[model samples]
Target: MKQSGNSLIEFLLVTVVILAVTASILALAGQTDKKRVNEELSDLATLTATAERALGMPQGHYEGLPGKLIDEKLVPAKMVDSAGHLQSRWGPVNLVPIDVGAKRLAGYSITYTNVPSPACPLLVKGGPKDKRSIRVDSVEVGSFGNINASALAQACSKATVSITFEHHLNEPGKRSL
Candidate 1:
């Protein structure tokens, strides 16, 4: 008499198909998560820079701040990640006022630091005309604040990847280079 269920070969074929489909789904899910994290990082960088510039305008200096930027409302109040860390999808956002100008009135340089895990390098693309486009994994950090064209180029090299929003205390509502 014939067997009542699937043959050995048929059962093995079905199992293999199921495993392959499951693996494909998992791979896609991971990619989607990475994309979401990258987008969140970009948004956080832009928002923090803009808020910091606004905060410094009235003071006429962007350096020697007294408190964490989050307290100043420069960063949105969001629930901490699963790890309970005050950070974006990447990691902690460190804003360092690089160079304070004379009397702190010439507009200071602010560096937005997002230390991504080595597995994921920070990647961002600027406007078409904007020269600050990151195309590689590592880059030399450059100076900001009323920087010269050459300095800007070096700071915004293809190997470098970061977003900088400039605001001069002298010019209200004016976006910086």
Candidate 2:
């Protein structure tokens, strides 16, 4: 019996199926990456917001802790959730993640919320630090997981993200979303 080669339509169908599977896999990976980036941003924002809130705490406010900041030996890490609740006492609040780090945790960085910031580089008529407003630069947040500062920056860069906090104080846009 003469052998018959596979039809063109059959080959095309197989190719299409293979391409579809590959595309789906790629799309899933991309989505996962995006989720990671967003999570990182959210964590960073939370960490910073907590710090700002701490500073805003009424001067006379008192808590059971000897020092409101936590760390008895030093200033504690100002940490809070998105709704404005303190989380950590003296560690990377959420940005670097509690479980992160090998020799150290990955993807972390601290930026100090600038007081009377220079002005939003992207906004117009952004005033000066005293009476003006601008986005905050890098803040001295605690550490990444248990890692140092530089390592955190390296981990977060993969998502084209830079951890930072908003200096929302006595103004309309103080808290982050």
User: Mind giving the per-residue lDDT tens digits that candidate 2 earns over 14-81?
Assistant: 99999999999999976765554344345444433443345334331122222333443223233443
Q: RMSD (Cα, Å) of candidate 2?
A: 13.9
> Which pairs clash in the backbone of model 1?
166-176
Per-residue lDDT tens digits of candidate 1, residues 1-177? Answer: 246345776888999999999999999987876776566655555554554566555555555432445455455555133443344553554344433345543443323344233212323332112222222223432222222444434444433244443334444344443
Query: Least lDDT summed over 10 consecutive residues: which range in candidate 2?
Result: 115-124
All models, RMSD in angstroms? 7.6, 13.9
Model 1 regions lying over 4 Å from their true place: 1-8, 58-60, 64-68, 79-86, 100-122, 126-138, 141-177
Please count the clashing residue pairs in each candidate, in the order shown.
1, 16
